[model samples]
Target: MIKLELIVQVHQLKKQGFKVAAIARKCNLSRTTVYEYLEMDFEEACRWVNELRTREKKLDPYKNQILSWLKEHPDLSASQVSDWLEERCSFTNVGDSTVRSYVRELRELYHIPKTISFRSYEALEELPKGKQTQVDFGEKKVRTTKNKWKKLYVIAFVLSHSRYKYAEWQEHPFTTRDVIRSHENAFEYFGGVTEEIVYDQDKLMIVSENGGDIIYTEEFQAYKQQRGFSVYLCRAADPESKGKIENVVKFIKNNFAKNRVFHQIESWNEQCLAWLDRKGNYQVHNTIKKRPIEVFTLEKLHLREVSYPLSFESNHGSSITRTVHKDNIIKYKSNRYSVPLGTYKPHGDNTVYIRIEQEKLIIQKTPEGVTVATHPLSTGVGQLIKNSDHTRDKSKGIKAYMDTVKESFDNSEEIELFLQEIHKRYPRYIRDQLQIIQRSLRDYGPFVEQALDTCINQRLWSANDLHDVSIHLAKLSEKEIPAVLRDIPLTEASSELIKEKASVRELDGYLRILGGA
Candidate 1:
């Protein structure tokens, strides 16, 4: 028997001019089942569904036993019921769906509603000032100025002691580089770095966790070493360990990003910062019973001072060497600024000299000091500031590079249309978008084709959307998502760095606590 919801969906798709096979694929139903449902009218389909529900189910023999179990454990799930049946009665040959359907019928007939079990939690003791900060990521779809929906990603940071929050938004899924940049921005906003930072088991930072041994990604490992902060990764399935940022992530989505019209990434972030100033930080916190900004003022004293490399100063500074990434870009102040094409060498040194002078970022070739690129520095996080000319090869030109990217896909015409839409949306950064698509093809391979179809059908015109769809498809197929990895060893000092520190109290405070002062 088919679900009434599936029957209704079949009829709706048929009205929408979808072919039978396409409907089958969309609904994950067999052609025969679809045909059987398509032959019935709405009333006939309702009758058929009701008749099937009343029919004797395979687990009807143990109906009373299941009901008694539900009475004892009101939060028991269908899957658990099926498992109990197999274990207690040695039941076999019944499909999971069959058991699920029968359990639903029993619940409805007996008026036994499923109850949700809530986990009990205790309020943890507050951390000492500047002891730790928690980080988390969140994404939401918001209405653009054109009234179309666009997805935005945000990384949130919350100081564990004061809950002083800082969040940054982007138009794309964050890479490891983006995560590092956000960390820098968070530290700058808080005026200093904490002794330790807590994080979830995010792939951007962590590569794998075997037993208690944690393996961080190569880029994150380098950043961790440079920043001199300890990292405490929460165990898998335990987000409550770092519940501060989890609540902050929800607070950002609900209070700021919710119902907000996104004009552009830069402006959206500007609005978020303004919101933080007025409402998010200024308002009284429910748990701490004080304003975050006020608590942060005192907590700021205990924080470690921000450090920078001796090679360069940030404000109107002398040049410092920065490694050019494979995408012909270098990081400056949490944003990626572009360099000329072919600057990144696969087999040789790819370092370039960068400096800030009079509010402009200058990129020059090393030793010779020949200028390669220059741009006004960006104030936003995760922005890709590119010069169109820098992405163009003198011989091939931009059009030829676009064609080369499109030809790499199976459906060149569709890919061309998608690329053209991306060009229209992001005229200045079309080359970077195209390079992202090329990388997706190299990484996701054949899955990129399906992802393209999804993007085109849904009218998603960004490379990030295409990349996200490809990852979704890859996960659905149980295939491993490809990523860059290195065999960097975790040193003993870093491993031991995450141990919790004991808070010390003054003798005067102890005397007062004992009422003997």
Candidate 2:
């Protein structure tokens, strides 16, 4: 074996800028042996110099396999082929890396392909606080309960100055609404919006028809107005603006999402968000030389607060009904959305509007400027709606309204009798009229209904879950169902008692239980 003394001398001499010939003279070795020692790793060089050594035993086997693979795919590179072999076969004596070198030499002997040229872009030197953010999406192939290959998109945002990141999963083929909602949610998450949002010309927000004028869809523009931020599209095909987000997507995929197998998109999504909070946010940014939280705390202090009060309502539901629950609460998104307790319910025919503000549910009587009860965010799905059918009369009130909601062949008297019972159970003044309005809900789609069911069953019901579900449905492009559909029972056979206490299964049970109750 080549002695440790010789290896040390060679490295030391090289460090001091000694030529190979000079070092060989001092070491009493031939120039070729000295040069070979320099090129090889210390352990290997020592072994070679001490004795005439045969090649690693597994080298020849790997060489044959590599050549066979390369002959079929001649353009394959060293790293690519090595990775393929590592996964399929295991060699006791040789590392995949040892195989890599043999393949490199074989390619050179045949004068085969070379590494492709890669263009390096110039990077900005001095990014300032809150001035820029990088954004990008990553995707993973998932097999849904339907046994289809579904692609899940995750959007990652990194504030350039702080390296603070936010990530959320989205369905593929981004839509105008998806783009807008994501921005709004991100702003709410960060507690405020930065002045500039750096993005690629994702088709949702960009119009190619007018000289590539970056025209946000009307909804997106309204969202931007609500937050007061500007959108910056990157140069066509250039990814540098959002490089931070791009790198983070890969980092999260490898470190966090890699080991997890998800039954529903929501499960994966919740884990992803939790991972960002626990791991990514707390880790220090390599280039920034400071922790992201440290930078965010400082940057947040400098941002301008909104001058006027803006309503950040969910796309799902804002319309309200006048009926109040016996517990003095109103229901929205599976939780008890409360209105002001002392407010009076008017006797005339009128509608109320329910709005979400800063995570609180607000109910206002329209045109009358009357403020009703307000509730803090709810914790369960069943609390969002009660039996609103009891408020109206059977003979003159809820009897007619029930006819519209029941899907039946009856222009018949029996249907009217059923409506009469519904009206009688829920008096016209409290529950009946509200149930009529609740029965009329048809604005959201099936996927959301399923997602809410998941949330409720898992006991993870929150504004965040509802928000995430709405966004998730919008991405799928399914027809809208009423946001309050869950208030209605999935099957008449299910008892009111069991249905009333229904809990959420988070995302794990969503696929199985998605009958939309």
Question: Number of clashes in every candidate structure?
Answer: 0, 45
Error of 1 at 261 (Å): 1.2
Q: Which residue pairs collide in model 1, if any?
A: none
Per-model TM values vs. the true structure: 0.46, 0.40
Best by lDDT: 1
Best by TM-score: 1
Root-mean-square deviation per candidate: 34.6, 26.2
lDDT (C-alpha) at residue 136 in model 2: 75
